[model samples]
Target: MGANFNLKTLTVALAALSAASIASAAGLDRSGQDITAFLQDGVYAEAVYTYLDADVSGYDNAYVGADKNAYQQGNKIDDIAESYDFFRYGVKADINDTFSVGVLYDEPFGAAADYSGDNNFVAQGDRDATINAISGGEVKDFASAANIVGKIQDKVENGGTLTAIEQAQLKKLGPAVAVAQADYNMEGEGTNVEVRTENITAILGAKFGENKEFQVYGGPVAQRVQADVKLRGTAYQAANGYTMNINAGQDYGWLAGIAYSKPEIALKAALTYRSEIDHNLNVSEIFPALAGAIPAAATGMNGEIDITTPKSVNFDFQTGINPTMLATAKVRWVPWSDFEIVPPLYNTGSKADPTNGPDGLSLVSYDKDQWLVELGLAKRLTPALAVTGNIGWDSGAGNPVTSLGPIEGYYSAGLGAKYNLTENWAISAGGKYLWFGDAKGQIPNKFAVSNFEDNDGFALGVKLSYQAKQNFN
Candidate 1:
């Protein structure tokens, strides 16, 4: 038999490692939806802060002709993945031996990426190139027609009459002038996007069975979400200069879970499920390049964008390997394939165009579900010190994913340490390094726009926690 050691005293030592888990997986997943704070044996509270940074650089595709049958590697895209940070807090208390309540707060989903190099994602601002590209190399003839139409329009607006030749030119120019004007307004910043979501969960747990070893918990969750997007450069072709603003919207969802624990051996296991949340938010969209085809798109349109965040399930388990060591495993699954964001005006304008057909397109979507798993071990080296190590793998949503958030999935390794400040308080810190998978960035119509390879990122986190054990003596 192994040496006799009370494992309950070391339960909180390595738990802080959850704070360092990076969120750069597919489909805007963040926070990992951790609920371990609610599983503590007593009154517990914690505050955690995490920072993540990714280096995602790639090459844009350069295609000639309208058919886009062939392409060559174009300009080098600089690192577009931006560094970001967020916070999490949780507090739980045992109402009695058989009842407990808790509240958890975290930013569960988000994205931050911006393109700034001289790549195709950046604005070229060349009038001739813009017209030539849109007109299939008919710059000379198209410019002449646009000039004639412009002169006649100036005269009419200035209280002057057009010559017979100018009137004929105006009639012949027709839609070309509108197209040219729309192209001229396309000069702006490069492609960029930022999305954010927050979740606050309130839970109530009931313990039952002999010795109260089993528990069932459930609660309501309130979520808030918002986003901003801008599309630029010739890489997007006719859809360049598009922009969207999604106002923040708040909604409600739910979470349910069951847990089993054996305190003598420090064994605890929990399976949690979170329902999907739908947000009907007001959005503003501008797609000037489509003005000639859908005149209403030039000025901009305001409508509702329906976004459904994916449902997810998480499993957390830990058991004592010996008196001074513990082993842990975590598994998570998210149905990213069922998630999508569709802005009303943008989809309508896309459908109105002959190329997009009747069904139109979603602003963003994933091709597959996501699965993640992590395994770890912890060792208490001293009475007040503990260390932990973990390795993880994530199966991304899919390759050829949306350009806005281009990373597929990642492999990661991490290390953490905790030091007790007193019997009831402790501080923990950890860091993780990630190796990202190669991917092809795509747009709504399944068009590959860029390629990313050999990228990596890192994450850092710190947590402070307090706990007071319940007395059964």
Candidate 2:
């Protein structure tokens, strides 16, 4: 096969070419659930690093009162820019021609958001509607009374007589002015959440046939989750300073998949399914005003909440256009509607919150499933260099997504490169630009918004691999 048969180059070309993507897809999913590592042909091990940055903007908060329209005008909220870093490691070995085993480690689901920006979304304040309106009204009446008093005083000094009504209005000026000078805004706090997940997969599989081979694999997956949510901001000012901390919980799930390949033409197709993991998380909550209050904390408010991460399926295919060129395609589906983040303590409503949420008291959730697709091509420009490019589309899970995790859909493109430093070592790098589809910024109690459209994201990644020994047989 000459130099045309370098397996190291295949790893580099497919480093960023999984067609399974990361970031801006759906429901805290970053790693696209790729299990292709188990399908590698020989003894292989690699470490990968990825950095993602997302810039989200165009936010609007609905204010409901006589003062609603004026307060939120020009409501271009914070540009939610966040940077995330991730690393993954994997090792696969073929004990013999028809049997293989491997282990993979990665951060499968996560989210980090800091609403601190030019917007008041995270501002520390409690500008109550009732208080602001009452005080503002006082100021309006005070100005009228003061103006009349000033005119009467000037007339009397200039030797002009004043009416009885004018004298009465003058008497009200002092107290009215005091009421007008009162303060309103309290402070902005809360309105944020953080999530993280880790996965470890152990696999065993067998291959059959000599020409177009067939293989099947299955494994147990262990997953862990953690979260911290601060309930403050526009709609949540009612719970303004409340916070919830979900202790990390680890559990087990499973996965199964099958693959077929024609190594000579570099063609392979595979399908995989990942099962859902359920967590009954131990949680602690803090609410400043509710401390030691009647019928609040003494009732086990800091106990547990049930959370379920959704299941998903993946299909991946790749073929060699020629000995030096490759093409690939992939599709994925996730049932995000079944995913939820509900705090049990918050589920019981108070007079402060009459609505328990029509969809349920969710700190994070979606109303629909997610669909994603990707296509790509790779070419070896020389024996030591290879380049690849791909395009992708994601059908968002919901049109009006929650403010906690807001995005509808996205279209993306990426470029990747690999350099073979030696027969045993290789380096790979890639970057992708994602155009977020327009979204109707939604808040529970179902606030409809035409905001959060045309936002964008960027992802960059690199990988290093080592091949200890080769099949020189």
lDDT assessment of candidate 1: 0.82
TM per candidate comes to 0.90, 0.80
Q: Write the per-residue lDDT of candidate 2 for residues 1-473, one digit (tens) a residue.
A: 52344444554576545422466467677888777767777777778888988887775654444332232433675655468888788899887777789999888888776565333355343233322322333333434544665787788789986687665544434223222222112244425768889999998888877642999888999998999876444444334345779999998899999999866667789999999988888998754333323245322367788888888899999877766778888899999988877776555423233444444466667888888898998888887788889999988889688766677878999988888789768788888899987776554445543267668988888888766543534
| Per-residue lDDT over 1-473 for candidate 1, one digit per residue giving the tens place of the 0 to 100 score | 55554665557555656767656487899889899999988999999999998999999877645554344688899999989999999999998899999999999999899998777777666555555554545444556666766777888899998788776555435344444455456555788999999999999999999989999999999999999998877666556677899999999999999999887888899999999998889999887755655676778788888888989999999988888888889999999999988888768756744667788988899999999999888888887888889999999999889989888899999999888889889999999999999988887877778899999999999999998988655
lDDT of 1 at 359: 83
In the predicted model 1, the residue pairs found to clash are none
Error of 2 at 155 (Å): 50
Candidate 2 to native Cα RMSD, angstroms: 10.3
Q: How far off is residue 353 in model 1, in Å?
A: 3.5
Error of 2 at 358 (Å): 8.7
